[model samples]
Target: MPTEHDQPATHAEGTDAAPLAGKHPAPPCALVIFGAGGDLTKRLLMPALYNLSSDGLLDEGMQIVGVNHGARETSDFRDELTQSLRKFAADRASTFHTSQLNEKAWNWVVERTQYFAGEFESDDTFEGLKQLLSTIKTGNVVFYLAVTARFFKPIVEHLGRAGLLKEENGNFRRIVIEKPFGTDLASAKDLNAHILSYANEQQIYRIDHFLGKDTVQSILAVRFANALFEPMWRREYIDHVQITAAETIGVEGRGRFYEQTGAFRDMVPNHLFQLLGMIAMEPPNSFDAETVRDKKAEVFDAMKPLTAQDVVFGQYEKGPAGPGYREEPDVAPDSQTETYAAARVFIDNWRWAGVPFYLRTGKRLAARRTELSVQLKTVPFRLFRDTPVDRLTPNVLTLRIDPAHGTSFDFNVKVPGPVMEIGAVRSSFDYADFFAERANVGYETLLYDCMLGDETLFQRADSIETAWAAADPVLHPKDGPLPVHGYAAGSSGPAEADALLAADGRAWRPLVDTRKKED
Candidate 1:
């Protein structure tokens, strides 16, 4: 049995080459993408496919069929995507090495891609799609619904009506749906039911781009691969865990969408909870999809129900230079939607009974970063209480997910002056400092995984519902308990969030203060 830990030694270009050591090469397939004319296609999906081609991971026989409502010649579609690829490269130049297009690789991808123009709900459109697939040599097919949430069911129904969902001649068929999987628990369940009606659980892939991130995946390796952290990963030894995902820029033109989906709905139930699951899940028998997902589901099931008092919501006010949430384009002046959210969550399981999981996320905040910090309980000071050294700070192990990728440990260290003084010092490991940074749009790993039938990084139906259940109280508070507070665009968040932790004699780690020092 091929384990998730298996990785192929090398990937060769030709069909005759054996599959790489641990990784099974993706079988020849056609990825039919709906809403190919949208920003997501040009910015993320296409770029990821191109990168896979450049890496020699994409199969030579694979094809990409882009579906949209407008008619365009194949050459015209290729030309437009080419320009988009150039712009994407230029935009990401400062971040990763793969920001620039590999001309040869781009050309290879262009040759294998085609465009189909048709209305998503039309029977003729899907019929035409079916006919196109018949002409290709693809042995597998992946229908990617990249359109708005509303179009998900209609497109999947059309695919089934056109008999595209059925397996043919030993070939497999899979459908990949993008996130905001559902608005809440009820809707998430409904959506899952509808999708499953058309496709089996094994054939569905729910994509959450955050899970594809390198640092996010590292959370698993840090806990399971090492014996140093797991034993101490409990309430007895850990004070609290803080997960913060802050964005410096405001909604940027997504005011309309943000109006319906606030911070709690937008980030907490999906991205943040996924992080929580990774950090809290018990070690699985293996890293395979079923085993790993089972462990993650257990984490969600063990979460204690939340109350209004356990959550705080905030809308960004005008900053020194930026507009407030209401002032943004397409936003209502009296909008009650929250752009910032902070919550204190608890797990009822034995390993984390009393440990509070502090979660926070906001747009137009003081910084653009995503990090997870594990604060260890302070050591007893009976021996050093009378010493000249001042108070000692508790140890902290932080995992930086973006804007920087790596981990750091903060601990007490003696001051070199030998005056019996104690200060906190951080030993950090940055990915870029040690390894070559490649061009990444964060979708490459996900796309590759999907092609290889790996659902370990994808969200399961149960996991989605479990997360929504935990977030229901905040989303639909009863008795007028939860209120949306206000914070300036450039500030951290509402002061009330700080008070949420303060009430427990703890404070949120300062976004600006990377380390603590004892005087």
Candidate 2:
């Protein structure tokens, strides 16, 4: 294992430089991953941490402590993690067809992994953690709660009693909590209040893994890096924005959890809202946590409060593969839970004054994909008389975040060789074509940010409230009998969804199916 170096050297490649170099360095800390025995830890968290450590972003004194409800010895747990990490590397290697694992660093990561088996609600078990902590001194601590929300308060309460929450003797403390933050507006507030009681707003980092994706983060770069976009990115030049997060898989084995939170809570409240804010927010004064968050909160707060007429909710009815939404396990027979939700929201702001944001997400849809499309308004007047109407399509900038990593811009152009036929041509920039290397995992960036006490991408309490405030009228029980529709599996959502936009003469973009090779 590498000994603690007073000043760790940066990676030789300039591309791998720390995101906020010199502004924030990796703090010497113990990253305690709660629910370490869970699938999330084995599949994502461990692999992410291992990768970060291998990249020289993590410190020599950095340690990872696992807290689990499982009954396994420390050695047995470590071995399990070691095997899982190797399996993760093998999976990654196979998927990307590359051997990028750092064997020496993998061994080091395995060596530093430790486990604590205890009940989160028990104060005594936490005292045991304090005893275990005595050996490591003068370092920061991050409690990563991958567990359920039911345990969120209990675990924090125990941590408070254990004297692990507050900074003392130059040791800083932080906690990372994963979503679904709440089921609704009221519950979200309650959860935020509970978490704030134990940790400061600065200390609590709410993780939304979507915010960490490379393409998603590229939105900032796409808009600001090029002068071509910034000048025309406004309501006057833009028609509307479409944000879609679709999935091909049905509830599958997540039936139980799916029955409780459907697509609205699962995707819209956090992920979709975050994407919208990123697209709509005014240029911040700086890229600091507060500045970016302040801009995002303003966007959410500016959203014209939804009304029933402005919202369209649909629960997936019986499809070719399985039963309808209400038929799912644990769902009430008459439950009005929405499996597919589409809404037209207005950001009553100067930049996006009249433009509508059409957002939608669903399960068992046409394809498995997530993307954001910024469609600019058509040309003020058409000069060509003989060209077909379809030829004059509006320009669009699409950011494909998952199932593929790329961006595309569609603009109108005259046909080649003596043809005045106006037609739209697409120019694309796919990451795969440029970088043969594997894209960094999303969780790694989020985990690294949380450990460094950076909340740039994490959702804040006020933003959460604003999101719910905007979404509540459409989502709440009192929204008054939402309409649910049945759509064929392996097909687009209900025709009603298409009609919802068709009335206004707009249509959803045809997304490529994941099972098929991209064209």
**lDDT of candidate 1 over 1-519, digit per residue (tens):** 222212232342532334434554555778999999999999999988776766677777788999999989989999999999898888788644745667877887888889999999999999999999999976578899899999999999889888999976667788999988999889999999998898898789899999988899999999989999988988899989999999988999998999988888899999999999999998999888889999999999988777888998999999863889999998999999999999899998989999999999999888888999999988755455344323577799999998889999989777787476676688889898888776677898888877777889998999999989998766667787368898988898999999999999899888776545444
Each prediction's Cα lDDT score?
A: 0.85, 0.79
lDDT per residue, candidate 2, 170-283, as tens digits? Answer: 566888889988777888899889878887888788889999888899898888788888888998899999999988877777767876777877888799989999999998
Give me the candidate number with maximum lDDT: 1
Q: How well does candidate 1 match the true structure, expressed as C-alpha RMSD?
A: 3.2
The lowest-lDDT stretch of 10 consecutive residues in candidate 1 is 1-10
TM-score of each: 0.94, 0.91
**Whose TM-score is greatest here?**
1
